[model samples]
Target: MNREFIEKLENNPVIAAVKDDKGLEKALKTECEIIFILYGDICNISDIVERIKSAGKVAMVHMDLIAGLGSGKDVAVDYIKNTVKADGIITTKGSLIERANQLGMYTVLRYFVIDSMALVNIEKQDRHGIAQPDVIEILPGIVQPKIIKKINSISKVPVIAGGLISDREDVMNALNNGVLAVSSTNEAVWEL
Candidate 1:
């Protein structure tokens, strides 16, 4: 993991999550130090990453959302590392996290807490050494402070609250609950 990047997250917990070219441009103009790319195609991803880096911001790609990247984790990971040269990668697959780690790239494993079963699965995954991401991103961040607290207590890695973060209050709530950072697609929240 990049200690500097981690420190940056600590200093400014709001991460700009860009979903399109316009969003990317908007994110670069923000005070955010990190940007999570939730949109890109194989043809344009490298350019997008370059643009983010040129702006002196850390770029983290949501690997599963990229188009034309194919389904093979190894191939996508390798491309993101060697080609895009992104600061990190976000994914829901543990295997992808493991692969990205091996490649010397930062990894964020996204988990959707839709129900109680999902919470149990998170613990099970951690126990089995499958959830070994540098950071774990829990979705619907505002609605589950208790669950977030539970995960934070047991998780070895830092937790990032993401999804459904609509405003400054939501960001603050997540941070108050012990999340290392909050990823939001809402540009308005970027200012917070």
Candidate 2:
């Protein structure tokens, strides 16, 4: 994890997770310092990233959602860095996170916490001495406080609460749970 990147996120906890053109436009007009580009393809992705950069915000492309990223391969990481020019990458695949890190790109590892077994992922990522991602984003953002505590206790990586983060109450709930930040596609939440 890059301390500088974490510092940036700490300064502004609301990250704009844009999945469409309207969302992107709204995000660029907000106070958000980080914009998670959740929509785009191999062709127009570069332009989308450029617009985010032009707005002077950190642009993080979610690899899996990008149509042309080829299932989150290392080469896809390369394309994002060398061609798309995004500030960071967000993915559920640890391998992609590792690859992005190797390229010196900020990486966010996303996880869907559906059950108590989410703790297994912490050990799994750490098993082979593999480095943890710069940040870990847990889906269904309204995860239980105890679950948040458990993850924080197990890993030092800053946690970002994403998915289903629709309003201020949800945002507050996540932040109060010890997450470093909250990412939401809801434009109103971005205002908060």
Identify the candidate with maximal TM-score. 2
- Model 2 residue 79 lDDT score: 94
lDDT of each: 0.87, 0.89
Q: Model 2 shows how many backbone clashes? A: 0
TM-scores of the models, in the given order?
0.95, 0.96
Q: Which stretches of candidate 1 lie over 4 Å from their true place?
A: none
For model 2, the superposed segments whose C-alpha errors exceed 4 Å read none
Top model by lDDT, which number?
2
Q: Which pairs, if any, clash in model 1?
A: none
- Across 77-163, the per-residue lDDT of candidate 2 in tens digits comes to 999999999989999888898889989898898889997677788657755647578998999899888888888887768888999
Instruction: Compose the digit string of candidate 1's lDDT tens values, residues 22-64.
Output: 9888999999999999998999999999999999999899999
